[model samples]
Each structure stands twice: as structure tokens, then as C-alpha cells.
Target: MKTDELDYTLPDELIAQEPTPKRSESRLLVLDRDAGTLTEDVFSGVGKYFESGDCLALNDTRVIRARLKAEKLTGGKLEIFLLRELGLGEWEALVRPSSRTKPGSKVVIGESVNATILEPTQAGRRRVVFEDGDVLSILQSNGEIPLPPYIQRKAKESIDTGRYQTVYARAYGAVAAPTAGLHFTKGLLAELKEKGLSTTTLTLHVGYGTFKPIQVDKIDAHVVDPEDFVFTKESASALNEVRKNGNRVISVGTTSTRVLETQYIDGEYRTGAGLTQCYIYPPYSFHGVDTLITNFHLPKSSLLALVYAFGGTELVREAYAYAVENKFRFYSYGDAMLIL
Candidate 1:
């Protein structure tokens, strides 16, 4: 498949700059994969389509304040976007004005947070070690939420801290949120529980690379960045039991879908922690997920490619067209789509 096949025209106004006031109030677009049908509904109605025994897999990774602004000893302004943690005080991050921040250069954030750039890595990433302290606490005081570039507004630190994250976010490592899970609220989860539907969680620390566009014309030639994920023994057993009991396994987002597909080996899910670079596109055979709940994706992105792979290309294109025509919001903080 050609990468161009995934491209679509989206009006600038359609990109959502902020989340809906209430999590469950966002619109839901339901796509019937087998029937090639599309329906519009509210996100709160998500439980209505699932059976009693279905299992919904959700990513519980938390978004950290990865975007930090600092100043060089020489007084040049610098930006550091943390991508992955390497150790207690070390991380791999993207540094702005990379040419100026060389190995051994020091950048200071506020009065106490200081870092030394160690070396350059692939994808313009820099290895940096910070002065030891409670890193999360330091970030809370000195960093800002790394909103997507297309949002087109300055971060409102007080508000985005809560809005950009999901209600169930537990593990703290993700630079980006598993956006599809954003529409779920505590009330909705309890409602699904009452309906006899259960949920299992896995963690995939969403990296900024999730937004990386497919550079190759041939879809097969595109490469994805490896992201950290963990599938515990408990989650593995729950998912396997869902399959054993003949229940559907619905994945909450592409992040969860990637982890599920990556861990599936031979005939079952493998439990443990590992790095995955699995890329899903058209003509791909899905081994774990029966249904997918995801947000609309950017054009020519690997995310859109995976959506086209799960739901047929034409169907997804039509659904996107419908979203545009009806003025449904797009991207992170956008409305959701359920592929069933």
C-alpha cells in the first residue's frame, strides 16, 4: 500500500484545540466493519454495543510534563522534550536549537533544576542527565504539558495538567496520552461494570514519535520508533480468559492495539515487559483485538494507516469524510470512532 493512500484533506478549523468540557460528552462515530455502515452517537453510549462478557483493554500510562523550557549558561533559551527515561536521573529527549547544545553543555531550568547534555542519538534525540532529585516533583514545578504542535495555543499549565490526561492514568512515563481513552470517565466505567463488561489495563508509554509521518511512498518501507510497554501476568490471564470464554476483546486505542498485537505469539498473548516497534497497516492480519475505539488521526500518519488496516480503507475514508462534513472535531482532544 502507498502512504499517499492514507492522506486526506482536513480543514484547519476541524482540528480541536481543547477537550470538550465533559469527557463523555464528546461525539462517537460508530463504524460497522462487516456491514460497511456508519452511525453517529454520543460517547456515553459506548457500552450499548458491547456484549456482557466483552473485555475492554485500556492503556494506563500517565502523561508526564515532558516539555521543559530552560536557559543555557550563555543565556540562550532552550527547550527539552523528554521522550524516555534511561535511569534515575537520565533521559533521552529532543532539544531545541540542537546545534548549540553540544555534549557537556549545561542548561538550567528555574533555580534548582539543572541538566547536562551528554550526547546525540538518532532522530535528533539528546542524552541528558539531570541533577538528582525527585524528578517528577521537579517536573511538576518546572515543566509544562507537551501539547501537540497543531493545537496552536500556549499551554495553560493549570488547566492542561488535568485535561490532557485520562481519569485512569496510573503509570507515569508517557510524553503523549492514549487519546482514545480520554473519553472514558469514572461514571461511564462504573456503568459498563454494571452491564457485566470488564476492563483490563496495560501500559504503553506514548512517545512523541506517535505523530511521526510516514516518509516513504511504500507503506512497507516506513519504520516506527520502539516504545516501552508492559503486559503483566494478571492482564495476560484476563485477556486469554476473555478469548477462552468466547468474549470479544475490544482495544481502547492504537497504543493498546500495538501492545496487544506485539505480545501475541503463536496462539496466545505473552506476558512481560519489552520494547515494541510494531507497525500496523492495510492487509495486516489482526491476532488479538476484536474491536477498536480510537480517535481520528492525522493524514499520512502511521496512526491513520493502522485505522485503515483495522477498518477497510474505503470505509475509514468515508467515515472521515462524514466527520468533516458534519464538523466533528479532529486529532487529540477530538471526537472518537468505534470500529466494530
Candidate 2:
């Protein structure tokens, strides 16, 4: 299918610059896949759709302060966005001015931290290793919460540093938050627990690839970069048990759904750690996920296409149109939708 088929025009004002004062206060657009209908509702009404004994899975990967600003010894400023850690403190990252600095170039941030470029990734990304020390601490002090380029906000104010993360975030590794999960609050989680809803975690350190726009005219021609994911034995065991008992597997975000679906096939669970480049489009058969809780996605995006695949294509299109007309927030740090 033509990538242009996925395009939709969004007004500039509709994009949320900041989060609502309360996480659960955001709007919820419930899309009933079975009924092929959409309804506007409050986010707190999320639990109304589910009864007791259902499993809701969340992506627990935490977002790091991954955007770093550094300069070459020649004092030229450069921006580095951490993508994926290769191992031994080496990471694949997006580099500005990558054209100027080739292999063996040195970069220093502020006065204390620095790194060396080992090489470049296939997509012109850099393979960089920080000067020996704790990379996380260095970023914590120097970097800011890396918002997507489309977001108009410039400075990472003290407020965003906290709001960008979900209350359930743990296992720190992500460059971006599992945005759909962002709408969930600690109070809401406690309520779900009390209501007899169980939750499992599958970590996918959300890399830039998940958000990078698909450029191919034919969606099938596009290639999605592999992102790291870990599904532990405990989580997998619990998920299989849920399926066996005919319970719902409610995926909290596209990240969890993509990785979980890849590992779950033929009614059996494969507990493992690996990278997945699974791209879901129309006609894709979902094996594990029963319901998906996700945020409104951007047009011409693979994420949106995946949703159309899960809930029929026409159903997603109508849901998105309804969301736009009803003033529901959009994108990362935006409102959410529960598809059942």
C-alpha cells in the first residue's frame, strides 16, 4: 500500500505542548473493535471496560536523559541522542554534524565529560563510547528529557523531567516512554490491583525507529530497525497462564504489543531476550494480544498502521477522526485510547 494512504492532516494547535495537570484526567477515546464504534470518555473510565481476572501488560522500561549536547575540541557544538547501547558502555546514537566528524573524532561535553566516535550505524547514526565512567550519571547531570523534534517545546524544564516518565517506570533503559502508559497514574494502578486485575511487564527500550516516519511509497518496502526487548520467564509464564484461562492480555502500549506478539505464537510462550523488527500492517494476524491500550498516533506512522491492523483499518480511521473532532490530546504525553 502507498505510504501516502496513511497520511492525515493535523492542525498544529492540536498537538499537546505539555501534559495535563493530572495524568488520569486526560481524555480517553474508547474504540470498540468488535462493534466498529468510537466513544469519547474520561481516562478514569478505563477500568469500566474490564471485569475482574484480566491481565494488563505494561512496558516497564524507564526513559533516560538521553539527549546530550557536546562540543569538539575545536568548540563546535553537537547534539547526541542515545539510541541503543551496543555493550561495554558503547552505544548507537543519532549524531548531528555526523558528516563533519568521521571515525576517530573526539567530542567533549561542557568541561568534564567526553566521548570518541568509533564508527557509524547503517542509517548514519554514530557508534560512540563515553570516556570511562558511569554514562547514566554523566547524562543525568548534563542531558535533558529528549522530547521528539515535532514537539514545539524547546527547553526541558524541571517539570517535564518528571512528567515524561510513567509512574510504573522501572528497569531503566528506554530513550522514550511507553507513551500510552503515561496516562496511567499510581492511584489508578492501585485501584486496578484492588479490582483484581493483574499486570505483567515486557521491556522495549523505545528507540527512535519506533517514531521515525516511514518514507516509502509502498508500506511494504519500508524497513524497521530492530529494537531490544526482554521478556523474562516469570512474565512469559504468567502470560501463558492468562491465555490458558481465557483471560484478556491487555497490552499497555505499541511497544509491549509488538515485542510480545513476536515472542507469542501458536498458543505457546517463548521466554527470551532479543531484538524485534516486527512491523504490523493490514492483514497481519495477531496471535497473543487480546486488547490494546494505546495513545493517538501520528499520521503516516507505522504505529498507526499497526493499530489499523489490530482493529480493522476502517475502525481505526473512524476512531482517529472522532478523536480529532472531540479535542482529544495527541502524540507522546498525549491522551489514550482503550481498544476492546
Candidate 3:
């Protein structure tokens, strides 16, 4: 199908610029897959859907401070946004001052660190190879938090660095937060456990792929950038137990869903840790992830396409229509939808 066909209009005012004071206080729009119905509630009410014995899968990929500012020897300023780690001192990145940075130009980030712009990579991204003895050390000492462009605030603010992350972030690799996980709170998890709802965690280092625009006319031509992910045998075993018990295996975000599905090889789930470039769109079958909890996504993006796949295309279209008309929030810090 044409990518444009999936696009919809979202008012600029509806994009949430800052996170709410309390993560669990955001609005929740409940959408039933079977009945094709919509309901409104608070995010804290989400725990009510899963009774005792149900399992919720969460992504624990920690967001790294990936934004960096460097100066060229020519006295030109360059903004470097690290997209993902490609190993061997190489990284996929988006370079500002692209015009000034030629293939051979060296951008010095600090006294002991620099980057050389290599050949251009796919999707207008550049291959920037780092020249640091310790890449992670250099980034930790100089890099800034990589906030999404939609938020019209300074990423240097204390709240930006703190509030942009989830309480459960553990594996430090993601450039962006799996925002759907942002709505969860420590108290909520404690309550879920106290009520006997099982929980499991995996890691999917979110890359720019989650936000990459649909450039192709036909959605079929679009591909994704590989992101680092990990699914251990313990989590897989817990999920299999849930499946055997006939309880719901609810995914908290697309990151968790992708990792779970990536670990699914034949007809069963396995344990593995590596990179996955799984591109999910509508009219596709989902082997894992029975239900989903996600935030409102941008029009025509692959994320929205996944939502369309889980909740039928017509259901997603109708729900998005209602959300727009009803002035619901959209994007990173926006409202959420629970598909059951």
C-alpha cells in the first residue's frame, strides 16, 4: 500500500512538549480490538485490565546521552547526533553543518576525541567514525541527552535528562526512550506484583529507526535501521509459561514487542541477544505479543503501521480520527492507547 494512504492530520498543538508531572497521570484511550470500541480513562487505571496471572513485558533499554557539539579546525560549529553503535570505532549518525563537513573533514569533540566524516550512508545519514581511545568514556564526559526534536526545550535542563527516562531503565544503549514505557511508575509495578501479575523485561536499544519517516511511495519499499536488542532465556521461559497458562502476553512498547518477536524463530520463542532490523507493518501476522500498550504515533510512520497491524487498519484509522477530533495528545510525551 502507498505510505501516503496511512497519513493523517494532527494539530501542532496536540504534540506534548513536556512530560506530565506524574508519569501515570497521563490520559489513556482504551481501544478494544474485538468489539471495535473506544473508551477514555486515566493511565493509572491501566493495571485494572490485567488480572492475577497475566504477564506484562517491558523494555529496559536505557537512553544514552547521545547529543554532542563539536568544532571543526576551520572554526565551524557541528552538531553530532549519534544514532547507533556500529562497533570498530564507527557509528551511524546525523551530522549538522553537513555542508561544512566534507568526507575528509575532522570534527574535534574534545581535547582527546574527534570524528571523521566518512561516505554517506542510507537515508541521508552519514557514517561518522570516531577517533577516541574509549568511545563510551568520551561520550559520558562530553555528550548531552538526545531529546527528540519535537520537544521545544533545552536538553541541558536537569528535568530533561531525568524525566526523559523510565524508572526501570537498565541496559544502557538506546538513543531514544521507548516512550510507551515512560507512562509506567515504580509504584504501579509494585502494585502489579502485589496483585500477582507477572512481569518480564528485555532490552532493545532504540535507534532513529523508530522515528524515521516513510520515504517510499509504497510502504513495502521501506526498511529499518538495525538496533541492538537482548532477550534472555529466563524472560522467554516466563513468557512461555504465560502462553501455556492461556494468559495474555501484553507488550508495553513496540521495543518489547520487536525483541520478543525477534526471538521467535520457528513456532516457539528462543533466547538470544543481538541486533534486529524487523520492519513490521499492517496485513502482517504477529507470532508473539498478544496485546499492546503504546503511545500515539506520528502519521504514516512504521510504528503507526504496527498499531494498524495489531488493531486492524480500519480500527486504527477510526481511533486516530476520534483522537484528533477529541484533542488527544500525540507523539513522545503524548497520551496512550491500550489495545485488548
Number of clashing pairs per prediction, in order: 0, 0, 0
Q: Write the per-residue lDDT of candidate 3 for residues 184-227, one digit (tens) a residue.
A: 89998898888889899989999977888888998889887788
Where does model 1 exceed 4 Å of error?
none
lDDT of 1 by residue, 213-243 (tens): 9989899999998999999989999999999
Minimal lDDT window, size 10, model 1: 132-141
Candidate 2 lDDT trough over 10 residues, lowest sum: 153-162
True-structure lDDT of candidate 2 = 0.85
All candidates' lDDT scores?
A: 0.93, 0.85, 0.86
How do all the candidates rank in terms of TM-score, highest first?
A: 1, 2, 3
Report the Cα lDDT for candidate 3: 0.86
lDDT of 2 by residue, 26-73 (tens): 998888977878888888879888867798889999988889988887
Name the candidate that leads on lDDT.
1
Residue 85 lDDT in candidate 3: 78
Q: Distance from true position, residue 326, model 1, in Å?
A: 1.1
18 Cα displacement, candidate 1 (Å): 1.0
Q: Between the candidate structures 1 and 3, which one is better when assessed by TM-score? A: 1
TM-score per model over all chains: 0.98, 0.97, 0.94
lDDT of 2 at 152: 87
